[model samples]
Target: MPLPLHLLAVAVFAMGTSEFMLAGLLPDIASDLGVTVGTASSLTSAFAIGMIVGAPLAAALSRHWPRRSSLFGCVVTFAAAHVVGACTTSFPVLFAARVVAALANAGFLAVALTVAATLVAPDKKGRALAVLLAGTTLATVAGVPGGSLLGTLLSWRATFWAVAALCLPAALGILRGIPSGRTEEQAAGGPALRTELAQLARPGLLHVMLLGTLVNAATFAGFTFLAPVVTDVAGLSDTWIPVCLVLFGAGAFAGVTVAGRLADRHPGRVLAVGGPAALVGWCALAALAHEPVALLTLVCVQGALSFALGGTLITRVLYEASAAPVMAGSYATAALNTGAATGPLLAAATLTTGAGKLGPLWTSGALLAIALLVSLAAVRGRARRRQPLPPSEVGTPGAR
Candidate 1:
């Protein structure tokens, strides 16, 4: 791996930490800010909404900027946002800070993925992409857990300060590692964004997006309420809650590691397999929440299988886009944010109807099934068309 990839991974770790630290700090924030817990919870939702709006907007705006500069700017913006969030005692002020942090997170992720693609050979892109994306899993495992602990002991404000501190080092690392920004070289008969958009016009892309949306919605809905589900529904001991989260995060980390390698061989097959496995995992979780062993097993599997498709799917989008790596990165990030926002809202409605945790699982699984169908169809369509999506350009004349 190149030095730049390692630096990007570190940067991603800081971004992921900042993005998710709020989940663990909500209670602390609510109490300190003199707001209801529900109100504080809105902070997380607001960030997701910010990501949905920010990803594409950032990409469009930075279309001509040097990629490293774009990424560095985002990191600085995120660090500043965290400082503001920590200092603000006012609810509105903190909320505004969250939006800023979210925009930075969204923009950084989009640009980072585009940078990853440019840093490696075409055949190794999947693994390269995975290295940076892995920071997300690390955040879930290490950052979120540590933040939760810190919020409980010190102050929620202290947690944000810690996040800001971590980011400074990450930004410094990027400065030391990655080269000045560059772009992919064009292939003969290279396709333009319009051509890529036409490919997206196919039912396959629509289905893939739908599936991504469903996967997120179900996961978030159920995940948001996981603590209650474990205690209320499954009757598990509160002491064991961390065990489940650890298991889930471990699964996610392992999934990313494996998916990175597998994507090079069969992006479509990985999605097809992983989606159904996640659907089954969710079903098992709902059916056997009372069975500690079964629940833990399923949660781990759910995390592992569901996320296994992530790198592969992103690579697929970029490949299909015919070297529009930035566009693919932005749009995929947007889709992910859309799902992140939608899943919880939709799940809330389902749970409000007196439907148990299982309701979200059903919805999620159905959506995954749909996504799987779409993936399969896309693969079949590509096979039928006989010409695989064109190879991306190495350094398109004006890509940088």
Candidate 2:
């Protein structure tokens, strides 16, 4: 029986909301906990660190378990962590809960990707991944805003309670929809741990992982400071910032939708196009910081291209690490989280150095340009290594 991919997407939505809602709740949390804003912000850092460390650790620990069982356990743990966070009044306890929740989130996502891949045909793996990731896109579009609204209307702790409640339904869906037995690929057995680690060390695989990190870092460098950019540089009032965020989220949803249709057929081409598009968008944003309309347009484009590039990059990693998809997925998760952590620091440093509000945009553009060059080199390398295509693939654009 095929697993219900939508259920996995729902589970991802639950996790994404928990991961992102923290940003909106930080100030309130600090006020309630009687801590400095800086200390409250460390909760976000703790969650990122947990994700970075948990991916490989979870993969290794759950390597022998059935995918369905692993996912169920992770999701349940995630829900429990959120409950602890919601109920706790102590800052340290809530912070610890966030870390535990993040660990469970990483574990669930890694296993979910593996299970999604197994459910689909080999040629449609990219589409499956895109579908699974759409949950995160939807979270940005709907869940984050909803959580923010909930926090604003009630207390931040109430928002945590809401997210924890949502996780129960997601867990039930996973239990009902996922198969009880191991996937065929798992049953057939994959490469040994030694072989999987060796594959991770390959130059091509390493380059793809590096590209993933750079792509995410570039996106976040500017996005993490969007509130200030909109207010100070673009000359928009605070009221319009939420509108801009919605636009960015909409673009991200569109990007993932397009990627779902095209990625399996033209993964390389998608990367080629998306990488340069993001670079151009970031450059335009830096130069047009004073133009409100231009800033809004460029932000939307940047969001779309960044997410489109991300989907294709994941597909590339899966292809390159075909023998160990689960481990490769874990590595990709860790790399992206690494970028997520690094981007904000870089953006903050630029601000402290007295670079104007446009510093983050320019910084993002520079990083994106380098990632684009690496992607182009990778494409050329792949082409050089290929033999003449069969009659079937000769006419296919993706074959190139």
- Cα lDDT listed for each candidate: 0.72, 0.79
Candidate No. with top TM-score: 2
Q: Which stretches of candidate 1 lie over 4 Å from their true place?
A: 27-40, 184-204, 234-241, 356-363, 373-400
Scored by lDDT, model 2 comes in at 0.79
Worst 10 residues of 1 by lDDT: 184-193
lDDT per residue as tens, model 2, 201-308: 788788888898898878767766676677778787755665566666678788988987788888767887788778888888889878999988877787788889
Pull out the clashing pairs in model 1: 184-394, 184-395, 184-396, 185-394, 185-395, 185-396, 186-396, 217-343
Which digits, one per residue and each the tens of the lDDT, describe model 1 over residues 1-400?
A: 8988888998888877766565456556777889865566577667778888888778767766776788888999999998998888799988899889889988988777777887788888789878887887787678766766676678778889988998888888777776664554332323455654465575555555666665665555555556556556778765455556666667878888899998888775787678777878777777888777888788778767766766566666666554455566776777766777776566545655565655655556665666667666767877877854344743666533
Q: Name the top lDDT candidate.
A: 2
